[model samples]
Target: MSRYETRLEDYRRRERPSYRVFEGMQELVCSVGQLHNNWLYVNVDQWDQDPVHTPIYYLDEHWLEECAEDGTAATNEQDEYIPLWISDRQVQTWFELATFESVVEVLKAAGKPVTLQMVIVAVKYYDKRDAYLDYDEVKAVTDLWFVLTKVRNHLTE
Candidate 1:
């Protein structure tokens, strides 16, 4: 194959990312030093090189869709790069990356709509439901959820 054809073949055969990539990705994108670590966390080969900036355009969006609690596809069309494309398992493996502040930043960065309700959902789903947080962490989520619910009700009513 010619050089261009070889590159095209490689791109067509791209593999799905592994769990470790999601783990590293969440850690890298978390609040600690996140501003400078927005690049892709790891290569498929799991190397420890500098951050790579490969957009997942080659991946199937359906394969990447977020699922409901019962495992059905959550179909409102998340429409943001991270929320729409990351797998449910990836979200479960994610930690600090799903906080309300980080979520706001993600939405804003993607130029997607950000709403208080959506923030509440992100906290509930990613932090409370998906992550394996401890008692104190769960309590923190409860507190945040309580306050956010009150605020949303007050604003909407």
Candidate 2:
């Protein structure tokens, strides 16, 4: 099986191992809830009350090596990469994009019109959900909004 499949199986069995977050400062103890858009939906026990999606890159070799050296890493022979933690910055970006995508999907499913206001609300919700917003997250939301706005305008026209 591929590394991704092995991780998925681990998640299904609720076997979450600890991994290091950004700069190896914090550890994330979580299980995989789902996968979407090539990202992992994880249920972090340390911070979030709910599951959150993060980029798969958090499990890349470099981060894993740092975690291993610190004795905070968790993996097995069947695993190629194990994601143990997510940085504050990564969480923000992931939350923003994932929430926005979810909102869009819900609107589509309900056959409701996707408006600028809806997208704006999604971004605002994420901004307020966290204690503080990172500058990179702010930029990411703004950039996504710009692109969405263009798409919306084009579709309407």
Note the Cα lDDT for every prediction shown: 0.38, 0.41
| Candidate 2 C-alpha lDDT tens digits along 1-157 | 9999996675576422332232211111121122222323232332243222222232334546777778665553334334334332223223322343454454345454434444444434554684333344444676787899999999999
**Model 1 root mean square deviation, Cα atoms:** 17.1
Residue 110, model 1, lDDT: 46
Residue 62's C-alpha lDDT in candidate 1? 39
Model 1 worst lDDT window (10 residues): 48-57
Highest TM-score scorer: 2
Sum up the clashes in candidate 2. Answer: 1
| TM-score per model over all chains | 0.22, 0.24
